[model samples]
Target: MIGVMREGGLLVLTLQRPDKANALSKAMLSDLLAALDDPPQVLILTGEGRVFSAGADLEEAKAGLATDPIWDQLSNRIATLPSLTIAALNGTLAGGAMGMALACDLRLAVPGAKFFYPVMRLGYLPQPADPARLVALIGPARAKLILMAGAKIEAEEALAWGLIDRIVVPEDLLTTARALGADVLAAIPGHASAIKRLIG
Candidate 1:
């Protein structure tokens, strides 16, 4: 359920299960995690449908996937990646998938995309490292609004709250992501990594 395309040092990973709203299955999560093993200089993650992810696959969630350690593992890997990671959100981001998107260095979403975690309503805890990252991006109160209060924030509110960096038209999403990464992709050997390290 992941499609990988690599060009030079740029890597793009797309969630491919559109019919399922890109709901992640165990195998799909594994594939996505595996894709990050050999870190690229610039990484962009986007989805192939109207929803980036509806979180865990329904059947898999019923089988305890909601609390799986792999979710934390995957998000952590993205969080610690030396390369610049961008979540080029093709659509709405929901549930557990919020971890991966929040972990990215920057987020660019389509105009109509919505952001919500809904874990409070679902009766499940978020991945271990997710809350801090979310809080860092949007502040504790705003993070609680989405996580504890189950607020469904749309693109504008998300941008203003700092949950997402920018909103781009669907057609320009990938183009904008690539443009944002151009400097990193063309940087001297360690320049991008050095800047990322300095930021943290």
Candidate 2:
């Protein structure tokens, strides 16, 4: 379930199924994909509970969800967005979920959040774009540490490694994300987006 909240020009997309560790079901993935089609100037992607996402829903994963092409499609769309996208990692980020976060413009995670993409251990490969993105934010060696070696990174280490931009307190996660997007929201219609394009 995806909970979309619009605040002025900012839209906060929350993964609403906490009972399942906010796992991404096929329906939830479809909802998220739909939500991104009309993104605001600043989009904040976060989760409702203590876990941003435990990756694909286990049941769905067993049924071939893990290798779905939609995963590649979703991550690619996020990467090409004109808006300033922020991933507000509310908690642990694992498995396939890393793709979306890796594609974001910036990542802010709570202090206790953990980051890992266990594709190696899971006996599956990450989406093609995902590995390239992961290497871009961090480095190829560090990317290998997680994707190849299955390393579980804590928020602090992730931040230091450039895997995440900031380590915010849980209570201030959304507020901080909103604040980070303030300038973008206030800028001329395409000013921020133009700057983002230049940076890329």
Candidate 3:
């Protein structure tokens, strides 16, 4: 499920499914789409507990891939969203979950959070849009290393590769993320939007 909260001009969306490692489900994807369509000035995405997301639920992915194009469309929307999108990676992120994090304009991960793209291991190809986004974040070489090897990179490695913007202690994750949001909110709304558009 999605939990939405407003802090000034920022909108914080938390993935609330620790029991399932915050795996993406059809309903959760739907909610995300709706949220992006009407996003706040700055959107902060994080998960409930120890895991940011474990990616698409295998069972759900199997069924949905046959009947829907939610994942593809969601990726497209996320890539083109006008707001300042930030992924507050609280814990481990894998597979399609990595796609979701990559979709964000900025990532602030907990110190020990692990990032992985494991689509190959699951007998599926990475999402078509992922290569470009991953390359944009960390360059072609590192992206290739991640996708080809399905390697899990911890926050420190991710920071060195420019895969994440910041890394903080787990206990400070939310506080740091909120402070970042506050910094964004401090700017005039119109200026913030203009800057986001210019940067994009």
Candidate 4:
């Protein structure tokens, strides 16, 4: 499930499935990809409760992986967003969830959130785009440790590795993300758009 709210020029998309750690379902992924097509000038993605995402719901993914194209399309939509996109990692991120976070242009993690890319352990391969993004954020060596060794890194380590842009207390997470979004919004619209295009 995804929750959407527009604040000024930004669109906030909150993953709403705490009991399941916001594991993405095929329909959910379809909706998310559609939302990305005409999103607000900035998009902020976060999750409910104490986890950004636990990745794809394994059972659900196993059932549809061969029949559905949701994952590929959703990944493409996220990677090609023309405007700003921020992943607010409110908590732990695992598996496919790591791919989702990496898709964003920026990331803000709560002080204790953990991150990992565990596709190797799952006997699956990440979408090709993800590896490049991971390498871009943290050099190839660190990316190899995460992908090959299936290592999990906490927020502080993620920040040091350049995987996350900032770390904030749990209670201050949303406030800090909003503040950063507002700061970006403060720029003239055309200039902000130009900068986003150049950086993206």
Candidate 5:
């Protein structure tokens, strides 16, 4: 499920489903897209509990391959949001969910959170955007370390590798993200999106 709220001009979306580690489901993905239909000046993505997202729901994935396109669409939607977007990674980021975080303009995580890619282990090839963004963010070599070596990157290593922007304490993740969002909103209107397009 998705929990949506607005604090000033910032929209906060929490991935709710702690029992399943906030695994992404098809319905949940649709909800995300719908929520973005009328986006605010800034959007902050987080999770209700200790897991940002467990990626695509495995049970649904096993049922059929139809979910692939939906996930791709989800990633694309996040990547192309008109406003500044932030991923407040409160916990581990795994599988396809990594693509979601990468799509954001900035990613901030708790010190204990981790970055993981299990594509090779699961015999699943990443969609184009996932690896492409990873390569753009880090580089071919470090991207391989994650896609090929199946590395589990901690906060410090991820920051060193340029995988994540910052690591805040667990209790401060949302507040920090919101404050950053406020900064983005305070900028000249449309400046954030323009900068994102110019740089990216």
Candidate 6:
């Protein structure tokens, strides 16, 4: 399930299946796709409880690989959004979920958050774009360690490696994200978009 709400000009999307650690399901991905069609100046993606997302639902995955297309579409949409995007990581992130976070323009994570990519370990290959973005953020060597070696990166290390922009205390995660979003919104309207075009 997905939870959608607007805070001023910011759109906040929360993955709502805490029981399953907010794993991405077909319905949830569909909801996310629909929400991505039109977004405000700022968008924040996060999850309910403590987990941001555990990637695709393994239960559905065992049924077939039908979810691949939807996953790619969602990742592409977020990566190319015209608006500034943020991934407010509430907890551990893995697999396709890491791809989503990497697509964001900025990331703020809870101090306890950890990032890992288990694609290789699980006998799955990550989407090509995912690694491209990872390489762009942290460089090919570090990206290789994560994607090929399945390295577990803690929040502080992630920040040091430039994978995440900031580490926020649990209580202030959303508040800090909002403040950063507000700063984006308050900037000259077209400047941010133009900058995104030039750099991205």
Q: Candidates' TM-scores?
A: 0.98, 0.98, 0.91, 0.92, 0.94, 0.94
Would you list the C-alpha lDDT of every candidate in the order shown? 0.93, 0.92, 0.81, 0.80, 0.85, 0.86
Candidate 5: RMSD to truth? 1.5
| Per-residue lDDT over 83-151 for candidate 1, one digit per residue giving the tens place of the 0 to 100 score | 999999999999999999988999999989999888899899988899999989889998899889999
Off by over 4 Å in 4: 66-69
- Write one digit per residue (lDDT tens) for candidate 6, span 1-200: 88999866689999999999898888898898898777678999988888888787888876754337777788889988878899999998977878778889999999878898888888888876788899999999999899999899999999999999999988888888888878678887777788889985
- Cand. 6 Cα-lDDT: 0.86
lDDT of 4 by residue, 1-200 (tens): 88978877788888998999888887777777777767566788888999888888878868765235566667667767666778888899887767667888889999779988787787778766778889988999999989899999988899999999999888888787777777667777666667777765
TM-score of 6: 0.94
Residue 93, model 5: Cα distance from true site in angstroms: 0.5
Give the CA lDDT, 0 to 100, for residue 169 in model 3: 84
Per-residue lDDT tens digits for candidate 3, residues 63-113, read 865235677677777767666778889898888777777888889988788
- What digit string (tens of lDDT, one per residue) describes model 2 on residues 1-200? 78989878898999999999999998988888898888689989999989999999999999999989988888888888889999999999999999999989999999889998999988999988898999888899999999999999999999899999999999999999999999999998998889999999
> In terms of TM-score, how similar is model 3 to the real structure?
0.91
Model 4 vs truth, CA RMSD: 1.8
Clashes of each: 0, 0, 0, 0, 0, 0
Query: Candidate 4 — what's its lDDT?
Result: 0.80
What lDDT is reached at residue 173 by model 5? 91
Error of 2 at 159 (Å): 0.8
lDDT of 2 at 18: 97
Residue pairs clashing in model 2 are: none
lDDT of 2 at 110: 93
Considering only N, C-alpha and C atoms within 3 Å, which residue pairs clash in candidate 3?
Answer: none
Q: Which ten residues in a row have the lowest lDDT in candidate 4?
A: 64-73
TM-score for candidate 1, residues paired by index: 0.98
After the best TM-score superposition of candidate 2, give how far the Cα of residue 177 lies from its true spot, in angstroms: 0.2
Residue pairs clashing in model 1 are none
lDDT of 1: 0.93
